[model samples]
Target: MVIQEQIRIQTRGRNTYNITGEVSEAIGRAGIETGICQLFIQHTSASLILCENADPSVRTDLERIMSRLVPDGDPIFDHTLEGPDDMPAHVRSILTHMDLSLPISQGRPALGTWQGIYLWEHRTHPHQRNVTLTL
Candidate 1:
C-alpha cells in the first residue's frame, strides 16, 4: 500500500522546527504496520534533518556552525535577488538534505529515542514550507 500526505509548516525565520510528532501522527493515520516512510520538503531554502532531540544546544551549535560555513551576503555569491540570505540558504539546503527516509514499524516512525525530525529553514525571513510524506 502507498499513502501520501502533505503538511504545511510555518517557520519564524532561520531556525529548526521539530515536526517529529506531526510525521508520527501522519504515519499512524496511514496505518502502515511496516514500510518505508519518505519525507520530502518542497522548497529550496529549507531542508530536513534527524538530529539529537535531548538537548536544544545541539541545534544551536549547528546553526552557529552553518552560519560560519555559509555566511549570508558573501560577496562570492551573486544570487542575492531576494536578500543576503538568499544564496546562502540554497547552499545550506544543498549541503544538508531535501528528503529523508525512515523505517515505519508498529504504525509509527522508528526513530531513535533521542532523535527528532526537523525542518531547517535557512532563510532569514518567515515563510510557509510544505513537506510531503509517502508511506
Candidate 2:
C-alpha cells in the first residue's frame, strides 16, 4: 500500500526546523510497519535534510559555513528580484536536497539516535513551506 500526505511548515527565517516528530506521526497514521518514507519539499528556496540533532551547535556551524560558501547579496548572481537572499537561497537549496528517503521500521522512521529531519529554510523571511510525505 502507498500513502501520501502534505505537511505544512512555517519557518522563521533562515534556520533549520525539526520535523522528525511530525514525520513520524504521519508514518504512524499511515499504519505502515515496514516501508520507505519519502519526503519532498515543494519549494525552490527551501530544502530538507537529515542531520545531527544532538547538539544545536551543529546547525549553527552549518549556517556559518553555508553563509561563507554562499553569502547573500553576492554581485555574481542576477536573480535578486526577491532581494539579496533570492539567488543565494536557491543555490543553497540546490547544494542541499529537495527531497529525502528514509526507511520505515516498526511504524516509525528508522533514524539514528542523533539524527532528525529538518526543513532548511534558506530565505531570510518567514514563509509557509509544504512537504509531501509518501509511504
Among all candidates shown, the one with the greatest lDDT:
2
Per-residue lDDT of model 2, residues 1-135, tens digit only: 889999999999999999999999999999999999999999999999999999999999999999999999999999999899999999999999999999999999999999999999999999999999999
Judge candidate 2 at residue 61 and give its lDDT. Answer: 96
Error of 2 at 24 (Å): 0.3
In model 2, which range of ten residues has the least summed lDDT? Answer: 1-10
Q: Once model 2 is optimally superposed onto the true structure by TM-score, how far is the C-alpha of residue 127 displaced, in angstroms?
A: 0.6
Give the local distance difference test score of model 2: 0.97
Q: TM-scores across all candidates?
A: 0.99, 0.99
| Candidate 2: segments with Cα more than 4 A from true spot | none
Question: Candidate 1 at 33: error in angstroms?
Answer: 1.1
Kindly report which residue stretches of model 1 are placed more than 4 angstroms away from their true locations once superposed. Answer: none
Candidate 1: residue 6 lDDT (0-100): 100
